[model samples]
Target chain A: MNRKKENGLSSEKVFNFCNCAFLLVLVVIVAYPLYYVLIASISDPYEVYAGKTFILPSKVTFEGYARVFREESIARGYLNSIYYTVLGTLVSVALIITTAYSVSKKTLPFKKTIMVFYVITMYFGGGLIPTYLVVSRTGLLNSVWSLILPGGVAVYNVIVARTYFENSIPEELYEAAAIDGSSNLGTFFKIALPLAKPILAVMVIFTMVAYWNDWFTALIYMGEKSKYPLQLALRQILIQSQATATMMGNMDGGYAEANKITELIKFASIVVGAVPMLIAYPFVQRYFEKGFMAGAVKG
Target chain B: MKKGKQGNTNAAVPKESLWKQVVKHWEFYVLLLPGILVTIIYKYIPIYGIQIAFRDYNAVDGFFGSAWVGLKWFQRFFGNYNSVRMIRNTILLSLYSILWTFPIPIILALLINQIRQKRFQRVSQTILYAPHFISVMILCGMLRIFLSPYGGLINILGEALGFIREPVNLIDSASAFRTIYIASSIWQDAGWGTIIYISTLSSVDASLHEAAKVDGANAIQRIMHIDIPELIPVIVIQLIMSFGNLMNVGFEKAYLLQTSLNKETSEIIATYVYEQGMLKAMYSFSTAVSLFNTVVNIILLVAVNKICSKLSDVSFV
Candidate 1:
């Protein structure tokens, strides 16, 4: 039945079938965990722990959320993440765009030198302690900007921005501006910046996602709990579960039930914290392709 | 009079400087300065501390004051017991993940492109993409419960199929850790990874596909001729980038999977750095290990990028 006796256009029948089957399997493998988690999060912890709620919730409960929110640190963690993401992205994008524009100019003497400085830093970074000391000695320790400022201008972003500036901005516009006695600064502000909106939008979404997801910096630099970003808080919650479960199993007389409940809450905390990015992704995803392609296609 | 003019000229020169130009065009500077200052203070300055890698760095002495150790840390790391285990696990895990996990997305990208039915494609894409957002902690939890030897879904299914008399302890087995990690990585990243591939595929000339169809090309042949060749550039780029991060086996996922039973397979450069450097407070030693990893990655990247540019059209640099 599958063999071709005479002439044929294509094995499209088998191809489409195989393609559909492949896609279906991939979808199931990937989506099942997310679906399972969503179902599990809303289901009663008792039922979930007992492994009763697989496809659907037998007993619904919001108690996991109640327990998480009531814990206090989750709320503070959200605020901390927000402060870091917004402030950091703003600062980083601004630096990237300006430096990109300034260096993009033909008239900027020794622009290549500054450009090289930026590029070298991208590939070679000082080890952790030296950076930690720099942050500490500069008295940025435990400060909000400490996390935000330290990672502000990503060199890759600068290069991409420079690419966009070089490719997208027309030289004739600059020449016209110069004819009208516009300075290099004026041309960038009025002409180049406005023309680079598509690239800018892409950078904004990319930066926002990066900043939002970043918790490693805070874990390294920010020692205070109040300053913990959501990821760090989630990490702490996971660590707490590991400690509590192991300790309760090992030495502690009781608290077994409490610890198990706390472990469930650890999983629940991850679900709650991820919703913001999930909600935000669809809006920004369309731009990711366009932005990256435009920036990455070498001139 | 000449000296007075010379002094005026020196002062006049800086006023012609970029910073002065920025102030004169304060509006532009106002817009750009915040980002500039932040990058300089935060990103650029920390990178300047790369010098400390050459020093016998001490917290009290600081980078400048520290004595020049000069590759001493590197020697100690190479000479240390069990350094080979980390090097082995790091390369092996990345190798397995890269070898097995990479093809799924490329195949997926090809499959998605072939599906003429837009609704099916969109729905499937959404389903596949949804899992990428779930954090590793939750995903690992699900894996623990599902892959449990007793009463786990997989084992239950296995029992139904009569594959095993008893369920296997998947997590506890040293061999199983890499399988789980690579599988989960494919699950999480394959769909999202397709976005790049699909984007690259979109640029593939439709005329070529049509020409293949006219020439009586089978579906397999069409893909072989058109889709695979079109994707070659993107594939090469991804290969280079992936090879660049060979040393950085992600801390979170590996650490989560690690246990007394599975530590042999699970430990890699990043986890070792964290445990030895951050946890153990062997700052110099840890930094030395991490610096070694980074240097090696750079060398590999340069080598890989060079080879890729020679072999194919795609090169990251």
Candidate 2:
């Protein structure tokens, strides 16, 4: 019996060690590439190409950052992205919270029917062309509203928000507020909304990140260069780099200067595109975990 | 006669009560108006416009004014040369991604749960989940750079390790596109997917593990007996839910990843729809194709949901 116990203890210890080792490997695999991108963004473009900047910058330079900032389109794209993200998040979160709050209440008449209406869209939808036809027919083309309004409310997020409202907010609070002569809307505004900070943070971050990252809407709806979001602008830079590189191939070393600049800007643009989210990550990380769990588990 | 009068009165009371309920919740309903309006306009209006899939769909003709073509466009799409290839590509991509990407998260969640140190677990999680937040265009750009034939890290490392005699142009190759796409997808999504499972794991009774340990079960045995069983429901639900959109892969990523060389493997249904509908303006034909895809996806979802419900209690519906 003692021998068996000793064997079990040794086996568990080995398993524990192996588990840690495997996870550490996973962490390195996931993290090293991101680390490389950061280092590559600051390294010399030639050295980046020469594969000398893997572990650290071969030579430090701010050329990439400088060049990216100097691009007129990048600045325009930045402002456009900010405007879209801010406005879209507000619209999306407001609509989501209101709808979710209404449906989460068990006393709300036809709650199940209202929920069915929302849920059906999750399984089936109007396909791409038809949706585009609707967008164009409404004359939303080449406008900011096209980006914000077409997909303003995500059904899945609404469901998650509803779950958060149902599970997290105590029903007694609403009852107490009701007894205090608060109307349903007042209860929502005064009591429920105050308690829903975690979900609200999640929704805002999710919506903002989605809007900031979205280029497909801009690609389809906004034909003008001025209306292009940062992602699309970055796409343009990417395409431009590829075009210049291919065009430079025939010219040998003649286009090398331009090629180098585009190369460096490629890395710099990634860092630029990701900077806001990365800065916000530490602050919002806990809420992200909570929000995701709330959405996933309850949803 | 008395019973009939009571039944009528009972019906009358429910109607009155419902009206009163509506009156009481009028503010909530008012708040819901924007959401309702948006849903109707953006989701339902276009759903109504799906009839264009059966019409000629000319801009001058408008949606209803266009001549009804019945199943003509569907026939044309089915008879198209690349129809089979497109179907194959779409299904294979979805299947491959599910197979490769699904298990890693389950394993990651398990491993993360096993970590004794809270700080290390949290740090690992943050780092792991970081890539999911990177925008598609930037992620694709990183892919291109990292897979470049000349001086890419992969190529350099491959050469150094004698895995390759010469650097290979990994991005442009058609055969390599799926691997690159799937790998990047897992890299981006796997960590994020683990959160659900990790959350599920937290609900697992610690006492059950203690019982297993007392029964002389080792760590692996406890995981097999307790953790895996606990996770099965979540995993099955996830799998069933995902099947609802089986035909609908990540449109943005696939579109961004497409190149002239990799177009053969990369020309999926979503991108093809965009090409035909937006780029070439074959509205009816493209709509028909997209409609077919959606229908098939719905059927798959229902079938999977039914099957999962039958096999186990876990299901989406």
Candidate 3:
């Protein structure tokens, strides 16, 4: 009976089987690296060293997590990341939505000129030194404003939000609001803002991610180590792992303990850094898709 | 001059009445103030600073007071010792990325389009695209650990398989940097990049696939004859966009991954610019080097945008 079914399988069935198998393999390939890190973070550093933690995590331990939480810099980095991401995302979204809504209006003056002005920046930009010089000249260096203000308004986000407003919001609502003696500001605040929740969510997610992941800005602008964001702090820890090891030369178990802790910390820090984004992802994911579909492609 | 100047029925008829237009939509104009202020401060001021590339820019002398050196900085960049090496490394790495990274998304999208199970498809997508959100620091750290000579998963596996006598320090090797860089980028982005293509493929008419099926065309045959032809324009547009920004090798990842051993291969123009401009304070010369990179990028962008428009009516512009 099994032989008969196998023989009777259509090409489509075979294709589906292969397709599923391929995707499963892809899932493993894509996910395993991250999964490996998570498992190694929790596993005995020895099991990880022995490579026995591959198929399943062996000798589970919370020592890495404990160490990470106990680290003062990591805690400070978390606070800094949160502050920047929240403040930056809020400012960026407000600017983007207001600018985009304004540009999306058919009656808005010089709309085409404004669009051209924005789009030109996408193709051309001042190189690093010039931009850095400008930032320094403005006395923005070593300030939180340096991170939030320099990239305060992304033109691409503006364009995307504009497209969303132009395509999604109905003209009748605006006209009706106008007829009802609603001023432009009133219509925008009452009508446009409420209708723009999806794009708003998209902007929030994007801006938050950008601010959270940004180290280069803080790396360049910050003169003090205390101002470093989580990503930059993580970079210092990872890149300067040798320094940590060498410093702990006379500690208990000597260089070996230091090396093992460094490895554990590396794995743990990745988990710490990534967990917030991953946690926030699913909640905003639907809005993300909706926004992308609405703005990114007409198809 | 304004481009969106249109004759209105409300009595402000002339196209040149900027004051009238501004007064008429005063609220909207007011709303635009914050965004415009930011653009001026952050974007245009930087453009004004680009002139420093041509001058001996002294912080004390300021913009206008800076000594006019004309083409000296550009000349110095071209005549520098590592100029050829940096340019060559940048081009080679970009080409390698384009070769290895570009096609995976298209192929993945094709494979994804074949899946019949909706739940599985969604799960796969979530799992796959998750990597895109991983920060570069975390990614580099992960790569460092995974590829370590001692007790790294890759090395351990290799040893277990008897592929080598002992583990190798892959991350620190010059020969391995480009491959690791390209591969990691592909791993991060390929899944996310499929979103646009998959969206395109979904909009491919169902009737065409049905017709092919009715004609006894197999899965491969249908994909080849129908799906790929429909995908060509999008692929071309994407390729053009990638090539246009070819010179902009990202600084963060390369800088994070760079070791003393791998510096020979990993030192691209962006990283070099950062070192010279920020670290060494060779502001003028580094500005010139980066200005060259930007100009090349813009030229490529314009050229490709033109070609794409002419060929496929799908230009990024």
Candidate 4:
């Protein structure tokens, strides 16, 4: 019986080990290419192309960063993207927060009708061309507002915010504030907005990422690269990478030329581009990750 | 007679008094004004440009001055050579993707749940979530390199093992396109998807699992009985959401992934819209197509939302 018990215990242990091993392999498969790219960016380009660059950098270099910054458009693009994201996120959050707050109130007249109207647009868009014509016709063709104003309230975020407010904010607080002779605006500004920190964090993170990552508007509206976002700039880099790749093909003694251009450096572009958000990630990770947690689990 | 007098007074409340009620609730209107103004400027006014679909949409003439052309654009679009292929490819690709991409994370989540090692689980999750941050453009570029016909990592392994006679052009082949896409998608997303399932699984009753163990049900049986059933509502909601997005094949990834070879299989509505509506200058025709697409999506959305509600009694609505 003791010998039999030992055999059963060892089988369960093996089962446990097998499960862990399978997941660990999955994790590596997903992560290594990305981590490898980061290591490759600093490695010698020769090693990168030869498939010898893995795990660590053979020669550490910041040439990729230096080259990217040397491009005249990179700085302008960074600033443009920053301006767009910051200004756009602020306006979006303000509009969404206030509207969501007012609509969340049970006593607000025409609330249902307004929500229905907004949700209707969420399901249907006028497509690209009509929207473009409308933007240009309004004389916003070359303007920043062309990018910013077209998509004001991301309806999904609004719905999430509304749900958060409904679930989290006690209806009694609104009543108490009203009984204290607080005006609608006062009550909302003081009580509701204060109580909305978690969802607001989520909203800010989402809006920031959306505005930052958005190049569709930049591509469609901004004819000028100076007005382009970082994504547009990154796209320019990729285009240049393609052009250079072709140009190198035309040159015969391409080994040295290839060495000059590193796949690691190319990979590093992603890191450089995403570095800002990664820096900001931890700050909002507390709320941003958990922000959706409230709604997701509750639903 | 007393009831008749009360009814007369109730009927005496005039339309003018209803107007008075509107005035009494003037603050509500005021509260709604700013939001309405923004929506009008940003949302509804642009919607009015849907009239372009009914016109030639001359850039020189603009919307109001453009000559009305009836359903000429729509007729032309549906009558075109590429129309059938484009529509069929879009639906097929999305259908295939939905079948593959939607359920993967749930499976990963279930697998991750049975693992009792806290450190291993945490590390695996972090590794998996990393790919979510990689942009689609970069992901496509990575896919290109990894699937390159010559000296690509995948081919090198295949050759060393004598698995094939020649290096395969994975991305270029229509047959291989879906597999490459699905694999990359799973690699990028499976771990991220597990988060939801793991959360759901943790809430499973410990006592229930203990009872199942006592009943001599093995691991697979326990999972079948307890875990999968618990995930049905989530799966239903996810399905409805996925179906609602049936028409919207994202432009960036598909556009990047397209080559001369796989273009036959890969072209979807979003990329087609990008090319025709924005890239080329077929504004009116493309706008009509887009509007038609939008209508279909909205109808599908409502239908699925209703279906989910009826079947599972769980819905976004």
Poorest lDDT segment (10 consecutive residues) of candidate 1 chain B: B1-10
> What is the model-wide C-alpha lDDT for candidate 1?
0.73
Interface RMSD, prediction 3: 1.7
Clashing residue pairs, backbone N/CA/C < 3 A, model 1: A150-B42
Native contact fraction of candidate 4? Answer: 0.38
TM, every model: 0.85, 0.93, 0.93, 0.87
Chain A: TM-score in each candidate?
Answer: 0.89, 0.89, 0.92, 0.87
Q: Where does model 1 sit among the CAPRI classes?
A: acceptable
Could you arrange the candidates by TM-score from highest to lowest?
3, 2, 4, 1
For candidate 4 chain A, which ten residues in a row score worst on lDDT? A239-248
| Residue A183 error, candidate 3, Å | 0.6
Best candidate according to DockQ:
3
lDDT of 1 by residue, B1-317 (tens): 43344345345443355555445445444544565566566556666665666787777787678888888877887897768988899889988888987888888888898898898987887667756765665566567756767455567657668997788888778898999998888877788888888878888898988888767787789889888987877787788778876766677788777777888888887788778766787667777888888888789878887887787643323
Candidate 2 local lDDT, A1-299, one digit each (tens): 99999999898888888888888898899888888888888999888887788788989998778777877778899999999999888988999999999988776777878889988887777878788888888899998889988884678888899898888888788878877899888898888899998899999998889999999989999999998999888887764354333322333355576667667778888888888887787788888778877887443
Worst 10 residues of 3 chain B by lDDT: B1-10
Candidate 1 fnat reads 0.44
Candidate 4: regions farther than 4 A off:
A1-12, A59-61, A239-265, A278-283, A297-299, B1-32, B148-174, B213-218, B306-310, B313-317
lDDT tens digits, residue span B166-255, model 3: 789998999999999999999999998888778778879999988887667788898899878878877886898798888887778999
What number of clashing residue pairs does each candidate have, in the order they appear? 1, 0, 0, 2
TM-score of chain B of each: 0.83, 0.91, 0.90, 0.84
Estimate the TM-score for candidate 2. 0.93
lDDT over C-alpha atoms for residue A205 of model 2: 91
Q: Which has the better TM-score: candidate 2, or candidate 4?
A: 2
